[model samples]
Every structure is written in C-alpha cells, then in structure tokens.
Target: MVLPGVYAPQEDTELLAGALSDEPLPPGAAVLDVGTGTGALALEAARRGGRVTAVDVSWRAVCAARLNATRAGLPLRVRRGNLFDPVRGESFDLILTNPPYVPAPDGTRPRGPARSWDAGHDGRLVLDRICREGPELLRPGGVLLVVQSALSDPDRTLGLLRTAGLKAAVIRRRRIDFGPVLRGREHWLRHRGLLSATDDKEELVVVRAELPV
Candidate 1:
C-alpha cells in the first residue's frame, strides 16, 4: 500500500512495468530503481529474478516501498536520498526511473506531494540529471529504462543517452489524458507555448538505453 505523500503508481508506472516485463533479467542481476515511489517497478524486477534496490528522495516513499516489499514477500533494499546519491560507487545491470517530468511554474523542487510530479518549467529538472547520471551506474551491457511525458521532450533524452555511448531508443509510448497537475496548468502550458490549445492528451514514452555488450 502507498503511504500518504508517496507517489502512487500511475499510468507511467504501469507503462514502465510492462516494458520491464520484456526485459530478460539474468538470474541475480543487480537492478536499481531510482525514484522508486512505491517499490512497484522494483518489485517487478525482483519478480524477474533481479536483486533490486530502490532509491527515493523522500523518506515517506522509502518507508512505503520497504513496507510494500515486505508484504509482497520480496526483498527490496529501499533507501532515501536524491537520485543516484544513495547508490554512488555502485553499479547495476539495470536502472529504472519514472521521474518528475511535469512542467511547473517554479524550478525549485516542492516539499510536499507536489514533488511527485512537479518538475521545473521545462520539466527537465530531474529528467536531465537522470539521463546524465544513469549511464554511469550501469554495468557494461546494462540498460537504463526511463519514462517521461512528451511535453518534456523525449527526443532530448534519447540524444543524451546516445551521447553517453548507449544505444538508446524509445521502446514504448502511450497517449493519456492529462492528470490533475497537468490539467490545472493547461492554460499556463498553452500560454508558455509548451502545449497547444486543443491538446488534451499527453504522450508518455519509455526510453531504453543500453551500454554496448
């Protein structure tokens, strides 16, 4: 169960989960789920026989994920810290992240539930960091899977990953109606030219970047 203030699994989370199902995890593969809100994706990896560790910047999320993993009878190492911080000096066979990619007016990270989806105006605040740091944590032949909204420019993510020497591409995409946070800022987004007046549905994309085998 998701604790209050922890990000509950949503469409993006499910989309990532489905993609994870296609990944053939070798037995005992080390997996890391950055921004593991409820341990949803982490557990999925564990189910596939990967030894998983989940990292979140929110303490509440870490506690929630830890609790959920215990109840699920899966052993998940959940840690509270900023992206990649808790797992520094360690690498993994796979990294999964559904980071904040909703564009908000302020660039500053929120201190409340808003932190779940409120990314800076361009929504690249967290996405950019993940792209840059993700590869460094990958073992050779490792893969980094990240989901982002179309509004935040998935192409940029692809470019960044490729620039880092990974063979990267959009593995999956889905169109969904705007969530509450996006609905509330529709006008602002349109005004800022990030969205068109007629645009009601946003596209979510999963990018897979693989280090050369």
Candidate 2:
C-alpha cells in the first residue's frame, strides 16, 4: 500500500519497467532501485530472481516500499537515504531510477509529496547527481537505466554517462500529456523556454548507460 506522501507508479515508472523487462537479468543478479517509492521496480527485479536493494530519501516512501514488498511476498531491502547513500561502496549489476525531473520555479529542496517530482529550477538537481555518481556503483558490464522528461534534457544525461566511460543512449521514449504538476507549471516552463506556447505534452525517455567489462 502506498502511504501518504509516497509517489505512486506513473507512466515514467511503467516506462522504466518496460526497459527492465527487456533487459537480460541473470539469475541472482544484484539490482539497485534508487528513489524506489512504493518499491514497484524493486519488486519487479526481485520477482525476476534478482537480489534487489531499494533506497528512498523519505521515511514514508521507505515504509511504503517495505509494506508493499511484504504484501507481494518479494524480498526487497528498503533503505531510507538520499540517492546512493544507502548503498555506498556496493556494486550492482543493474541500477534503475525514475528521479524527480520536473523543473520547479525555485531551487529550494522539496519536501513531503513534492519530493517525488519537484526538481529544482533546471530539474537537474537529482538527475545530475545520479548521472555523476551512479556510474561508480555499477559493477563491470553493469547497466544503469534512468527515466526522465525531455524537458530536462536527456542529451546531457547521455553525455555525462559517456564521459564517465559508459556507453549511454536513449532506449525508450513515450509522449505523455502534462500531469497535474506540469500543468500547474506550464506558464513557468514556457517562460523558461522549456515548452512551446501550444505544447501540452512532454516526452519521457529511458536512458540506458552501461559500463564496459
């Protein structure tokens, strides 16, 4: 059950899951799900025979994920921490994340439910960190899959990962109408030149980055 303040699975989550499904997960592969929310992706990895570890910055999310895992009878290690803090020094075969990518009007850190999607002005506060730090946590030949909006600039994500020695590319794309958050910020986004005057949709892309063996 998703507790109050926890992010529910949305199109981005489904997109990432689709990418995960296509991946060849070996038996007992080590998997990490950052910003796990209700542990949907973590549970999916666990169901596929992966040893999954999920991390979230919110206690509500942590509790919700743990509860969901128990209900699904899946083995998921849920931890409460920011980004990679919970899994520091650990290596994983696969890392998945659907981080907060909506560009907020300000740079103040989000709290409560906003933490799930209210990324700072440029929307790269969390995304940039994931791109920079996520590579180091991957085991040789491992892959990192991230989902974010086109408004946030997927090209930068690819460049960052490639510079870190990973082969990065956009693996999936989906056009979705603006959700409540985006709709509310439509004017601000247009003011920032992130959206066209008549644009009412945003494209989400799944970026896959892999480390060489």
Per-model lDDT: 0.92, 0.95
Please write out the lDDT profile of model 1 over residues 27-129, one tens digit for every residue: 9999999999989999989988899999999989999999999899998899999999999999999999999999888778777888889888789999999
lDDT of 2 by residue, 14-46 (tens): 999999999999989999999999999999999
Model 2 misses residue 168 by how many Å?
0.3
The TM-scores, one per candidate, come to 0.98, 0.99
Number of the top TM-score candidate: 2
Candidate 1 stretches greater than 4 Å from native: none
Predictions: Cα RMSD each: 0.8, 0.7
* Candidate 2 off by > 4 Å: none
Model 2 has an lDDT value of 0.95
Worst 10 residues of 1 by lDDT: 106-115
